[model samples]
Target: MKFTIILSILFCTSIWIPQNPDLTLDTRKDPVSLKEAAKNHFKIGVALNERQLNGMDDKALEITKQHFNAIVAENCMKSGRIQPVEGEFVWEHADRFVAFGEENNMEINGHTLIWHSQAPRWFFVDDEGNDVSKEVLIERMRTHINTVVGRYKGRVHTWDVVNETILDDGSWRQSKFYEIIGEDFVKIAFTLAHEADPDARLFYNDYSMAKPGKREGVVKMVSNLQKQGVKIDGIGMQGHVGLDHPSLEEFEKSIQAFAALGLEVLITEMDVSVLPSPSNHQGAEITDTFEYQKEINPYTEGLTKEAEQEFHDRYMDFFRLFDKYSDHITRVTFWGVTDGHSWKNNFPVRGRTDYPLLFDRSYQAKPVVKSIADFLQNP
Candidate 1:
């Protein structure tokens, strides 16, 4: 009877258990982070805001150090934050941001050198508030890039030299840069950024790149830059996705499209929100506004088990895709360290509760964290 029972127990265990057993075993260990899980795959990064950078939120800071191997300043490194006036550069915030990255031994990503938004109001206007001449604007741009990029040439490794220059239709967004310098603004921006730090890798970053038109536009732009002898290193696809929008097929198609080019692909500003949109609009534009309704912000109290499980499944699917293309991807960065700090709560609609990252508001690893580790480890 004892021998029969032992054989039966072994048979039942094999039927219920994972083939390798390590997959199930890893999930039982202390939560493993995206960085460690993807350490061999690619860099894992997070964007830090002023409070987190200053350590005002100690727990958020602690969590960031534990998971991220790369860091990008959420606002400190932007043009407006770094240089609000014509020549006066605000060094306090930017300095600390870089210092924090250096201390953590994280690869620092300079948020941007030239962007249509978050640029100082003074950049496009003269003393009397008239639009500046193209030559003057270009000169000011070079100076801004030189100063900021020179300050941290060796310390910061990658830079978004220009952002959101391509529209969804694959045409140039008619911004101050384009209107002032025509289409050559992108070329000039990359040139000056490279001049400031030749060693620093420069990237063209944008949102909605999963759209076929936008992807084609970016690819054409990068190809043109290469033909013109520009030093474009990578393309940053801002991964601000929701639970339902952006089918995995579309996102993967973009990854394949971008990798076909010679540059490395970076999944930047990543976040997957598990909440209903106020107006069903999917965008991260600062100017986008929506009226807050409790009905729309149902998850303000917190996500239900069903919602949480769906979020877990969505994140796992995305990471599986990331791992599949890890060879072509250089880095994958979360937009924020924790859900509490996510801009999704305020973007497109304000004061709406959202859970978008691997960490919860309490800075605890969500169940998805363990799953991500197991997925990559087992795969």
Candidate 2:
């Protein structure tokens, strides 16, 4: 009876081996990056500036190469910066941006094809300084899209064809394109982008995407485009989230709704500002600049322990949410690399020391980075 019991125990303890044990990532690597940690889930990206593109900011570029697998031009690719004057394409900066991405094997995203701000003054206004006629504007739009999109035809994997077109109230933001070409401008932009690079993905990026009205409106608008047989592949919810505003629940709703519309969701421009706002809630707009004040820039010394903890929690929560919907989200691109590189430092209120990004000013990973990296390690 004792021998039988021993044999049964040995049989029960026998090991079983799988055919593909390597399919699971060994997450025990130390000092892992946000991009590598979450790579199996989805891509991690960062936007680039002139310094990084020109190889001036060696530290930022090194961190980028180590951690990130995707890149977008922070300003160089913008219409105003690239074109400046009509028909005079300044391709040097953009070329470098693409070259950097290609060398690193990173997925490249073109920031914008049409936006009200940051375009050459000549883009919308005529030689007489008036808004150009619809025909002239559409033709100019066609040329701009074709030229820019055609330049990086297969290099850029995705393009922000139209940016921030809808307001929080679900109404179209009136710009030269809206006033002259009407809503059809969105369709035209997508068509031109598709014509320029049919293989590349096309996306409509916007801010305030979590609001119910805006979410609904974007769904309907994109649905209409899909109905018209326009190949809109993704929607970029500018992740310019704050510590408290735009509740996580609402943001998830935006993802679910967009995914329901059969569109992939890209969390573009993600950063969490941990500073008291001048107004109720500030936005990421080039026109939304403010005069620097001593009081608003309170964290110049450094963030308080409480504030830092809160910032860390906010990031972990958002990333956990991102993990939850990893299937629907194809990419999550931080707007900047480190806290020092963030635009939030001067946005809405200038000179404010906002601790909004995953890395500190020194490019060291913060607690939130560890939290995310740890999570990825475990999974």
Using lDDT as the measure, which candidate wins? 1
Q: Write the per-residue lDDT of candidate 2 for residues 1-379, one digit (tens) a residue.
A: 2234543443344222112222124333345787878877889999989988888888889878988999988999889998998899999889999999999999999988998878788988887898889999999999999999998999999999999988887888888889999999999999999999999999999998999999998998999999999989999999998888789889889999999987889999999998877777655766876677787777889888777777867776677667667778989999998999999988888767888887789777675665677665553
Candidate 2 lDDT (Cα, 0 to 1): 0.84
Off by over 4 Å in 2: 1-30
How far in Å is the alpha carbon of 168 misplaced in model 1?
Answer: 1.1
Candidate 1 weakest lDDT stretch, 10 residues: 16-25
Sum up the clashes in candidate 1. 0
Measured on C-alpha atoms, candidate 1 has an lDDT of 0.84
| lDDT over C-alpha atoms for residue 57 of model 1 | 89
Q: What is the C-alpha RMSD of each candidate to the true structure, in Å?
A: 7.3, 8.9
Clashing pairs in 1: none
TM-score leader: 1
